[model samples]
Target: MATPHTIAVAGKGGVGKTTTCGMIIDYLCSKKTGPVLVVDADANSNLNEVLGVEVETSLGAIREEMAQAELKGTIPSGMTKADYADFKFSSAIVEEDEFDLLVMGRTQGKGCYCYVNGVLKSQVDKYAKNYSYIVMDNEAGLEHVARGTLPHVDTMLLISDCSRRGVQAAARIAEMIGEMELKPGKMGIIINRAPNGELDSGVKAEIGKHGLELLGVLPQDEAVYRCDCDGEPSSKLPQSNPVKQALKGIMQELGL
Candidate 1:
């Protein structure tokens, strides 16, 4: 089977990265470029909240359980430890009509996470080919990508919130990706929640200095905030919402 076109979204917190990731998934599914796999690789996973989906389990939660079981030497009869772990991992994938979400629930603590991350990478590698698009909403930084725990990325979209610090944070992520030599097919910076889906000269200059391409700007829309406040799905935003429209343009520019 052919591999899916993977798009990984990364940025500092509070930059609207998760919301934009949701928008990318929504846009792709709307275009019938599914079945899309949405990986909430963020430790503080809230992608489901934005998508209005429920998750019963997460990779981290089950990893802890399996590891503890192994420590206690309680691998069930007739089932290898690997098989039991795989079963739990499969259950972590929450199915939805338009997409499937696999969340990396909590932050890693002390001790090596190699075994769990290894299983995650193995499972992702195994199942990724079934989808046409895999959109990963990563954590605030480049930890997962830098560790090389996830599947290969086709494109990486770095998001900023039209602030100088936010842009610099995105630039740092881009720099880290370069230093690590992950070499995604396409990499670009997106200015999110901008005043009018437009960037001023100063922000453009800052982005240029980092050698990052400005794919497009997403305008601020109060409707998005209202939805968040009301605990509603971002995908439920009206077609006329500026943020939604801007994201559509951005996706088009990226040729997604």
Candidate 2:
């Protein structure tokens, strides 16, 4: 087994970050790059929905169950606590044709997530070598990265809408990544939902001010909007669809 290339897509909410991640996974599968491991590190945990997959459980849910079961001494008679946890963790991964989805669900009535996070990190480390690429859709902020919930990123794609505030938020995340010394091989910003696939001059200026690499701009496509409205996976968008095409081009530019 070889090390996998990990790509992390991050942005503020409502910026189409998850949708972009779905498309990236679709593109990699379409190209027959290799098996992809998709981790939804977002607490909102809608990556499965965007990918048209049903998730029966999440790591957080499993963690909570393990904690309760331990308190109640409900571990199976033969299996040790570690074995039971491994069983539950394996069950949380939703396997798909092209990729496997692991969602980090929200904690409920939690004391802290430190234990579960360790479990997730170990699982991810164990499973990572089997895939050629690992793509993660992260939470709005850097909580996942700061907490070391996921693997080191190879490429970091920061997403932003055509707004100054969105860019500013992305810039702050980029800054935090630098301060944390993640040192991703490639880091850039994708301006999504740009009208007519064009960036506002002010937005360009903002990007310049922050010194963020402009990876590409994705147009606001009606097809994508309609797919979301219909609860269809954006990956189902046709290749000729503007959003899909634009993203494909960007990925090509990145040599993915």
Candidate 3:
């Protein structure tokens, strides 16, 4: 199935999932790049940081207040579903060199973020229709997505590090999506920080066990770590970066 939306990356923390997504954004931004909308669904969104943009309002906050306002039946004047969605549109898209971003920050401890997530997903669907592509840096769990943040996605990239725990997290996300059976346009897996030389046959088997396609492996990039330490724009990663090259390879295989 041909999908207009390019991709979404989800996986365990510390797996370099965010960096991979940022690299994809950098690639897409550099090419013909009509407006591209990036939705940072992770509560701990540093996509803004990776890309070197300041993150402002988060979508979670907007929805929380919107729900409250709706309950009061006194929504701020000029706020209807249509108006609200528009406000969300205006609030979310952070303009940069060639890309736009919509951040959904970490949920407050109040409760599940499923409600806010649903609204975001809805708006994102509508938002994507207007752009050439949408890149979502998703939250850790696939629960929100399973609940319908994005029932149908173009491609869901499950990322994991070379650890058993990271691999387990990816497996769980895949299982969550599978249990929900929310058929996406396409979905796959990409293991990061793969060990070199001596094989951990146990770990390798665990990766192969998943039904999703294995896209590629990314060696831990010291450049990325250094950039983060200095708060640099990861999008500007030199072509010599190993992870950057691996990400490009993954994108090509996905036909982006």
User: How many clashes in each candidate?
Assistant: 0, 0, 2
Task: Enumerate residue pairs that collide in model 2.
Answer: none
Provide TM-scores for the models. Answer: 0.94, 0.96, 0.85
Worst 10 residues of 3 by lDDT: 194-203
TM value for model 1: 0.94
lDDT of 3 by residue, 215-253 (tens): 777776677778888989877898667777877887888
- Kindly give the stretch of ten consecutive residues in candidate 2 with the minimal lDDT sum: 110-119
lDDT per residue, candidate 2, 55-135, as tens digits? 988998988898899999998989998899889899988888889988888668844766666777788898899999999
Model 1, CA-based lDDT? 0.85
Prediction 2 global C-alpha lDDT: 0.89
lDDT tens digits, residues 50-138, model 1?
89998888888888888788899887889998789888889999988899888877625775656666666787888898899999988
lDDT leader: 2
Candidate 1 residue pairs that clash? none
Q: Give the candidates in order of TM-score, highest first.
A: 2, 1, 3
